[model samples]
Target chain A: MLEIKNLSARIGDKEILRGVTLSVPDGEIHAIMGPNGAGKSTLSYVLSGRDGYEVTGGEAIYNGQDILALTPEARAAAGIFLAFQYPVELPGVGNANFMRTALNAVKRARGEAELDAVAFLKLARAALKKLSMQDDMLKRNVNVGFSGGEKKRNEVLQMALLQPGLAILDETDSGLDIDALKIVAEGVNALRSETFSALVITHYQRLLDYIVPDKVHVLAAGKIVRSGGPELALELEARGYAGLEAA
Target chain B: MTALPTQRLESWRYTDLRALNAMSFAEAPAASLPDGLPDIGVPRLVFVNGRFDEAASSALPFARNFAAVDEVSDLPLARINAEHAHDGVTLEIPDGVDAGVVLLVSYANGGALHPRHRVSLGAGAALTLLEVVKGDGVYWHNPVTDIVLAQGASLAHYRLQDESQEAFHLATIRATVAADAAYESFTAVMGAKLSRAEFHVELTGAKAHTHLNAAQLLGGSQHGDFTSVVRHKAPDCSSRQTVKSVLCDSARGVFQGRIEVERVAQKTDGYQMSQALLLSPTAEMDIKPELQIYADDVKCSHGATIGALDEEQVFYLRSRGIPEDTARSMLIRAFLTEALEPVTHEGAHALFEAAIETWWARK
Candidate 1:
């Protein structure tokens, strides 16, 4: 389970996340739907411990540990993953090498045996097949010349391989098309288990139709204004985020 | 001998030799060969201090005796090299002969050492020369190499300058390519407290080509300089230069590349790029790219980029569970991929890669 209590953070002088409180239990996927400038991305960045964000007053506890004090890599090793909205382009880093290195690092931190080249390739090939991605995807540099949809799918690919317990997807469906969206959704669905929980942050309700969430919250102006069952997302989509900040 | 060039000269602006001039170096004493020398399974010539070691070298027909260097040049370093250089390689390849590989190893313990090497390839000849320079303690290594390639000849020169942290290495390389000839070279600068490798290449005939690529990995207080001048004097000639530097601690890196196209050198294709990655707040890089084109129809371009590692890229890697140090290394190796792409020789590539790995580990 992941617990975020009174999560107030800022960038420089402007406060972004102001007294935000939310929780996602085990075996559940929650959707955080919000309008523009609602501090959705800031929430994900703060949870992952990215630089430049100052967490003024809050404690993010994941599986009984105060993860707000951990480094980004430490949080990742503690089973926290944040799917970036914009995947970084690594010009000369091969995708296979990157994934293998990341996987081995996580494994090493968890006291698990690190995978060799052969074993890692076998696992990667299997992952690619399941995602319907071609083998050449592994041979190219990491997102060097990838298309918009391809970059999103690559993020899902990383999510599938890493298998984090709590994934915070920050606007991953923005630039993705329908076909790529299904592939990404399937990648998340395949990892559904009792120990797996996800915080899917998106603006449109179309993605929620595929991977239905157990709870939906409206985050407006850095605070959760309304919370309800999965139908809350469809209601907000129909009524629009207008006047919700006043609620 | 001419005096050492000072910072007042435009070409020596970034690299200062006052420290070297202040130190008084005695003649290098004969020292035993160091253990754990790289054996690339080829014909090798070993030089300890400033003297050639015949016992440790393989006997080859083309490996002739060291001849006196009588060539005079305006460069002070070259003039100094010609004056004091006693023993060096004189390799001469016959026409159409493929001299597979030759390894030249230079090891210095201390003091001043200068070795002048000369190589000439006949028409349609091919040769791959790998030179490794290393030393210990404080010393001065100033070597000059002269290469001549006849018509249709090709020479691939690879150098690894792994000197000691307290050593000074200054090398000058001059090459002349005839019609249909190619001179390709790559150097990795991973050692030495202060080092500079200056290259002068001239394409004197039609269709002659050259590629001068290098990578400098410096840490601590080390300073590395790679300066090159490619002169295209004939039509249809081409030259390419890609230099990359990774600086850490208070290290400094410099790249000075100049491309000159003569009036008759129409259709000349020249390109140069210099990039640097500064890993610390104190590390510095200087890049100067110049193009002097007298030809009416020619293509010449140069680019340079110097900056710290991208924080967004670092965060992306760290968010994926890669440790900070490993993430930085991965990005740095990526930065060097383009500069190292031209090193096709398998053994030499591996050796350079190992040297880069060692430099990273020490940093």
Candidate 2:
């Protein structure tokens, strides 16, 4: 489970997330729908402990522990995963090697035995298959030349491998085609379980059609203006947030 | 060993090796020579004090076509300051002989340790050369290496510079590549108080390929300079140069890479990139990548970046549960991976990686 309490964040001198609060329980998928500059990505970044973003107020708690004080890798070790809106390209670093290092780092933090090269390769191959990704992707540099959809799927692949307690997908549906979206959604759907939770950050309800969120929170400006059942996504998609200012 | 030459010496123009003469470099510890060296050897020629040590070196049996020398009487020494100019070793590969891993080890220490090595691969031959340079005690090391690759030959050379911090080091590597030949060189400098390395490559033949990569990690008051010049005299050759420098504390680093292409060398492709990461605010670095291309049809590009650590990446790793120091080390390790790629020997790669990690721990 993850909790955000009055999380206020800013970049430079401008405020981004102003008194935003949300929570996602185990086995639940929460959707945050907002227009451009709604602080959607900023929320994900702040949660993942990115630098240069000032957290002026409140805190984020994950799995009964304060996460705001943790480093990014610490948050990751604590089972907080963020599928970046844009996957960074690490040249000369093999994709599988990076994934394995990340997995082992988290695993070691959780008191789990580290996986060797063979075992890591097997697990990575299985995860790639589940995500409908090719095995050749394992040999290339991390996201060096990956397609946009491939990068999104790779993010899911990492999430599945790390088996994070809370996974945040930041605009993962942006560049995915219909098939790729379906595959990505299937990857997420397959990872759904009683102990898993996710925050799906997106602008449209198209992805919701496949993943099917249990709760939808409309985030405007910085705060979550409305929280409702799955039907909230459809309502927002039809009516748009143009009228939400008065609400 | 002789005393340091006066400042009037032309060779010591930019730097004064005499500054180290005042400090009494303690006697060098006895070395129990390498035990059971691997037979995975190629054509090897060893040098000590900038001169060939024949008794300590071995040559291939019935060496006919290839030219192997145990001594060179006429030394064309360049940097002769004072009366102490030492001799060096030289080796030449005959045409049409493809040699495997050629390991050249140079040991320098005490007083003035100057060694010179000359390597020439004949036409259509392929060779791999590795130069390992290190020493103990406070000493001065000034080693020079010359390599000539004839037409259609390929050469790969790697240098590992690990000297004592109390030592002053100066090394120059000059290479010439002929038509259709390929030359690759990599240098990793990890120690020394004032270590300066110069790399010069002259591409004299058409369709020759040249690549150079260097990584210099400096801490304490260590000073490292990787100055290089690559010339494209003929057309259709490709060249790539990348230098990465990491400086900590009061350490100083410099990267001056110049690439030149003559007007006749059309269709030349040359690229150069240099990046410096300063861990401490007091750490200093000077990176200058120059391109002087006379050929209008050549594609020449260069870039230099100097900055502190990437806070975003650092935080990303830290938030992943890695400690602050560990995160910085990981990023630095990743940054160095690019320079270490040319090392084909996995064991050597691991050794270099461990050295980098050890240096990071000291930071």
Candidate 3:
């Protein structure tokens, strides 16, 4: 469902994601493991069309359509979701209002009937229950005063609500504890289907144990150095990135 | 209205009232009036060019002829109201009575108008007051309101000043709260070419509370000023003042707020904040928030912020699929919510909320 070829990007004078390429077919989850500054987050930002990320070269395609040419919002309407590594704090904007507006916007773009306040609240409450979040969370400002784990879970909540065709998880497991990791993994695991696909980006193999990936790609020096089955993650865990770099 | 204070004057330095000297004024004939008052069975008092029209007003028990001039009148406009204001209203709420609502409407019919209103609430009384000022054509609207809240009494006042585009509006209010009394007021300004609203509030007795909240939205060449002085004179009294201004195009706004805690006013808590959002590069705002505390055991703070739209917040909303314009509007509306939240009347809140949206949409 998603493909990238010769993807190269940079910020200002420094180059990141130099000639990186990978593909995640429909119904499959691909894991990208890299050390700090391995252009992992840059890849997510580029896919989501974040500003200041100059796309030097390469092409990213989603569902046989060019994803690089669309605006961030348009990409969202086309079923592309990016769970930001650090969710921004939106003061005075309620979480429930944000989600409902987002859901309605995407629905309108897809030519579907939009949900009113009553229907929207019902759907949101059910989603919150599934995610083990309290109902009062909807009343608070978006991500303000939320714990690190709660922020990640909120992102997962958004993914569940948006139900995008392709989701880019950018370091979502970094700050989460063990329980939070499982809840996040369960939330993603629950969405496993023939049509749903995700790119699990992380530096450790611990997350792989929970949301076992169909494919593993070791990203180093801004490129995919190796691609293998799930066992590849375990091998990398035994030998750190430094050991692999030496070899 | 013609004299502009030079920069040497502290309070009126940036606001040049003399700019209004060039506009010609005319006597606005009594014409059709708009539905400016809310429908809450509020006894209505209508004034045209400072004269009460018996045909257009419904009498309340306190409606009476103007008394002699007040010795406290300081400015030329206040003195003008004291000398010329006719058919003024004096609303007195009896002890322990819940006087529902009282509506005061002042229309500057293309000429100089001075409408004086006095409101007094007896012990244990409660009331909600709506005061609206508007007019058509070139006119001068000078209104003075004095309020006294007795012990344990409470009052909620909503002031909507939306004069015509060619109109000049200057309003002054003085209020005093007795022991354990509560005074709350919210003002929303959307009209007038040159307008100034001044408030002087005093917490006179122990355990008193006062809150003054305002939101001013303007575009074009319009100018607005919200100046207020709040004094905490009694022990354990608290005061809060919040002002939000949105200026677009070449519009200019000003906020001058002074909070004072006297020596005997121990345990006083006072807060003042003024924030302005400039939508255009040329749009300007001048804010001066001051705190004077002679009391040793008191807590008082003041803050002022002048900024444009937060780009990160804008992008955050845009990424959620809300259009760029819609996202900006939402953020602007949210910014005004803090000032509007303290407004107690349901009808008045909805009305002013709609006016804010309409102002932004009009831009």
Return the top candidate by TM-score. 1
lDDT of 2 by residue, A163-231 (tens): 887889998999899998998898889889999999999999999999999999988898899999999
Residue-level error in angstroms, candidate 3, position B207: 1.7
Instruction: Please list the residue runs of candidate 2 whose C-alpha ends up more than 4 Å from where it truly belongs after superposition.
Output: A12-15, A243-246, B1-77, B81-87, B233-238, B260-269, B290-297, B315-327, B337-342, B345-351
DockQ of each: 0.89, 0.43, 0.54
Q: Give the poorly placed runs of model 3, Cα more than 4 Å off.
A: A243-247, B1-7, B24-28, B35-62, B65-71, B87-89, B105-109, B134-138
Q: Measured with DockQ on alpha carbons, how good is candidate 1?
A: 0.89
Q: How well is each residue in B103-153 modelled by candidate 2, as lDDT tens digits? A: 666665566664556678889988777777766667777766778899999
Docking verdict class for candidate 2: acceptable
The C-alpha stretches of model 1 lying farther than 4 A from their native spots are none
TM-score of each: 0.98, 0.86, 0.92
Q: Chain B in candidate 2 has what TM-score?
A: 0.83
Interface RMSD of 2: 2.5
lDDT of 2 at B179: 95
* Model 3 chain B lDDT-worst window of ten: B23-32
